[model samples]
Target: MSEFRDSGTFQGERMPKRPNIVWFLAIGATLTGVAMPMGTPAIAVSAITSHPNQKSDPPSDRIAAAMRAYLRDLAAKEQFTGTALVVRRGEVLVRAAAGAADAEEDIPNRPDTVFRIASVTKQFTSMLVLKLRDRGLLGLEDRVCPYLIPGYIRTCPQAWRPITIREILTHTSGIPDIQQLPGFYIKLSQPTTTRELIQRFVNKPLDFKPGTSWKYSNSGYILAGAIIQAVTRKPYGTVLHEEITGPLSLRHTGYSRRNPPAGYAKGYFTVGSPAPPINGSQAFSATGIYANADDIVRWDRSFGAHTVAPPATVKQAFTPQAPCPSNGCLNLPSSAYAFGWLVDRLHGHRLRYHPGLLQGYAASNMYLPDDDIAVVVLSNVEETDTNGIARHLATMALKSASAHDH
Candidate 1:
């Protein structure tokens, strides 16, 4: 055993000590008293080489650390207050929560915090329509007017009366945006039945001939939701819960108007001196889906796994049906409308993405099928650039994958 002792030196002066001698009978020479000086060069050498200081990070960990640091800096600079998640082939690569869920309470956002998904809910409504088609209970080719209330398409031009479910899913039904109709917003605040909602727009005129052009009309999706209700004999929300959210075990996802979960971010719009909170009602089917980043990822994965719709049906949802004209599309450089998703190209990679913006909440979800990458961003701020953040995260996740490949 080796033992160490501290030897103090005063002004570089060495202290002396007495030595002892030992005699051996068989040895020719006697063991004489010998003085071995302590704190010599050998002791100093061992102390210097004992344990060298070094960093603990491996190369992969170092890269991940740098990426996290950059994300933190970017979030702070951009004033991003949301949760971001990145998953590759069903494996979570990164799940980070930043900023406050409720700014007033100073509660930091968490993975399970839910927010109104806004237009992202349209995808779920579209999926329900496609599922019904797969079950042979409905046909996309059937004219929607016949199944709906009488005069449902009377306001549309005579040429557009033959609009089909496929046309509505593809946003080519030529129905006007409900928000643009007079009294639509006011009526949205009220508990209007699906039939009443349809009747209100029955006499409205179409913007163009059906299937001749692409125009995103919320009324078209609401009509689809109503059709789901009519076919299933259940509320739209209940169908969504049973068909989509339930089988996936998405506990944090739901359409609720009563008490929401704790730590939920209050939606805010910057209008007056201080932005007022926006609490959306439960009646809106074209837009209302309350979920978090984690839940959204699960929802996206359901497509790849064919958990909600068949693989072919899911494929149709991400395939561009028609080119979107101005005033109805987001103007993505390489994007077009599919069943509900926006099919586009990002950095030469196919992307299925969508953004949801309501009164005080904004959310975005993106999936790169070729690379099996998906990302979701959920924010409470109505005007936040959440699409930009989602793009950045997707880029980072892809970059991480490329680096791993090398």
Candidate 2:
């Protein structure tokens, strides 16, 4: 079983800042790709710190070149071994991969190489559940107990307010994270049924009451997946494949365990060795999906196309849920997560994205609606700082679009 962390809670989360390049870019009115070493940390430093004016735009070619240069630098420094893509209005600005898919075999990583996308799978789960709700198969306000196995919820009758689907989707459900429980990693690798899975975790009292506050819990999604199965009488992977992936012809997206395919870029905890494989059954819908950067960009654009869910419903998922009336929302300046997405701003443009981290893989996908831009980064190597790189790419793409629009 995979021991999953709330991928939303990544360390080194950063806030917006201005860098020395602002005046340089605004006054110079051009960007020439830096002649810095590929392994230099300077590009990442500037990308993170150099804030720009919303109106101040730079050349498209210059911005793209700088973005590539930044990734090249990152690949050298981090020894990154996956693909990175930045797309706007269906145009790919940057697509690059580095390092080895299987180092012992000396196979180089390619843009098409598949990697387990980890908790980024939550976004797909949220979309699937919301789509069901949109079609009247389920209700966000509906109590979860009816769908979950009987006698399972009896253990926590006092805490179970029939946890609403909305609560589960928003991570506001009072459910405690099963992964935090004792012997979680040991339990993770064992084969367990969905009913048994819920029973194992549902006995504890909720961390907080439903709809009252926010705490990221994979268990809530675990329940949501159960609800989907109970309502549709289909396997979780089957639902995703038929409803979402099939509709889009997303040739590269699905659960890594249930539907094993060839060409998987071996995920590695150590640079030279493979991470121990966990039972996919234990991960379920919470954190057990995989895909490539190219396939993910299609999933990102599903927001605009409304291919899977209606625009209104997808918009609701993007909108941040209301916070506790008494405590107020957490005072986070850098970004906030609503549903499955990280909603933030880049140089005054709106960005909605999600990051997923697993034992040997790291992935992040970003989309800027106002700018019509999307960024995808997936790596077989851990601590790739996928989201950070994706964000920097967004910054460069927006800069290019801004210059073009002006």
Candidate 3:
């Protein structure tokens, strides 16, 4: 919300269209050699640590000038409109924002500006599910149907009856996304309950049989949220608060079922377009959270510092769980997925990440465990290349971090 650069702005070529992997893919890899839940080993697990005041993120002069200029160039073209941040270990290497929070009010984006994290919210949901698993309240491999008191109610042509929680996390459950279902917008025009949202698609048949295939499904997460509620006997939001946010003190993060919390960014399909309305009830644990760049970094660090779970389970979620097989998997190296994260290798380094998109928000939260770096990006403009920006900045930071190694 303050000045990025008042003297002059630099111009670089606009960000190119990388492969269109934005929201179409599942969660991905990180930690090339850290240990996760299943006895898998990733190398850099020893380096993941955080101090009590890891919030100090002074911009590092070590970051290349071109990287900073590139973000500025994208903003100058009205292509970028939110916050981007890079944290290596516990230090902030790059922190910047471009464009307005409310274009009508001419609010500038800032380091602390909140944005709808969209599907990145899934990572949190996944974490909550894992926490329950660790406590022996539920098993990850258990069938989801038994947890639902109302049962799996969907009208799709398939007579499928069983889908495991693991299958849901890996996008192999074959449940069709409730949002893409024919009458999603009508059913989602206003607030609704998790059970009500699931009811709308309860009778739908399976898009694909569970566990044999993979496809992104928001309804699968709705089912997951329902499972959480059924087990805890509390609302998903309440559980998220008690189990996750409250412990972490993530003051800026929430389930965001009604109006976006005070001081959050107003999303737009285009720069001059009016803000779009959201049905938070429809999103639930799948995509109903709002957060700032700083809180997101804290979330990342928590996972690294073993604040979330034992090392092995953390690695399991970050570990690549499914195959790419080009079934609409975005073109990437080893483009497999995991629990609410995409676990893949880019440039021979393990990367765990997820990209989220909503009506007017685009977000990507990525961690490169081999490099001990995490990138958090939130953009209000729907069309902005937030995922690309995160990828490019992480690549640049890795390069810089590599250069300093000598």
Candidate 4:
């Protein structure tokens, strides 16, 4: 812990208004294209291979300067805090950080600074489930209750019996969101087991009949985590490493259950003001993962290189499973939901993305398959619109690449 500073530009017009806790913590996405399982050796290389005839990114100096200055502007206005990484055709365009990771200690943000990834964890959790499915250990349509790990000595609620793994993965299972439950804040403040957390919300009636409607539910993913544990007989974190991160050599990414790991960013509400605290375990499989910008970029590349799964299988996860109506879903209006991503078109190009929010942290991960561009923005400031930042950067990158092609 470090001393909190009271005096700064955060006191001026630069300070952001606190966002509604419910909406801010909603951490959510959609998309379809491919599905893959982890079995082959991970592609641990730093550079992704460019596709044949893939357009080159705009001149490095121009795009890099444009992105760097844009990030700096956001930081100067206290609008952003954390790191951003952009890659085009497997080449690095901009890897930059703005604001402080540990404001009290005056530690500046860096590309390698780790932050809790919140709902972005859903993708990893979904991947684990899909890999299990590929192994014939479980089916996407399997009832979640049957595979759930029996923690807290609790039985599956009658209501959950009809919930399938696919419904949960697509956020259409109708299991009420755990964050929206009574005493959710209090419950998350204390360290608890997944079963204990589930016990609190298990009895709640379904918001809608399974598969009939869409609602973002962390509880559904928690149940997904439980199923993973039951089937693999391994903890979620253990399986995450054994199957995904370890094989990919993504040393900086893993599940952190209670405290920020070494070199991790200290979350903030504003410059110098510490963010509220919550037990990481409360998020469990829904949002307990953490990673640096570099690791996320590497993870994205794995999908493109088919290092994580077969091409056809990889396409399964990215295919839209649930449609987002005109009102929009997550942060993007009218985007459809895929396994762990949101599917929409960015300037007519297929875009798969997700945004995550947790106490004192925000993250956006977007991949434009057509452009082969990956833009990740991770912020330690709560309520910061990292998704917006990431989208803006992605669009900018795409435009630059398009310009170069012409």
The number of the candidate with the highest lDDT is 4
- Candidate 3 clash figure, as a count: 31
TM-score of each: 0.77, 0.80, 0.82, 0.84
Tens digit of per-residue lDDT, candidate 1, span 130-204: 888888879989888666654233344464569899888778888887767787545544454566666666667
Candidate 1 colliding pairs, count = 1
lDDT of each: 0.64, 0.68, 0.69, 0.73
Residue lDDT tens for model 3, 184-236: 76655477777678776667778777888777788778878888888888888
Q: Give one digit per residue, the lDDT tens place, for model 2 in 1-406.
A: 0111111111211212210111011122221211111121212222333335434324755786687677767666655568786776765565566666666565556556677887788898988888898778988898888777462344435567567888887778878887777776676556777777777677687888777777777888888888888888888899999888888767767874443366577778756667766566777888888777667877777778777677898788788764523332222223456777766778888878777777778888788876678888888888677877887788888878877788
User: Candidate 2, clashing residue pairs?
Assistant: 1-188, 1-189, 19-50, 19-51
Please provide, for model 4 over 337-386, each residue's C-alpha lDDT reduced to its tens digit, 9 standing for 90 to 100: 99898888888889998889987889999988767788889989986889
Query: What's model 4's lDDT at 150?
Result: 52
Candidate with maximal TM-score: 4
Give, for candidate 1, the lowest lDDT window spanning 10 residues: 18-27
The root-mean-square deviation over C-alpha atoms between each candidate and the true structure, in angstroms, is 19.9, 10.6, 9.8, 9.2
Worst 10 residues of 3 by lDDT: 18-27
Question: Which regions of candidate 2 deviate over 4 angstroms?
Answer: 1-58, 151-156, 187-190, 256-259, 322-335
Ranking by lDDT: 4, 3, 2, 1
Q: Candidate 3 regions off by >4 Å?
A: 1-64, 151-158, 186-189, 327-334
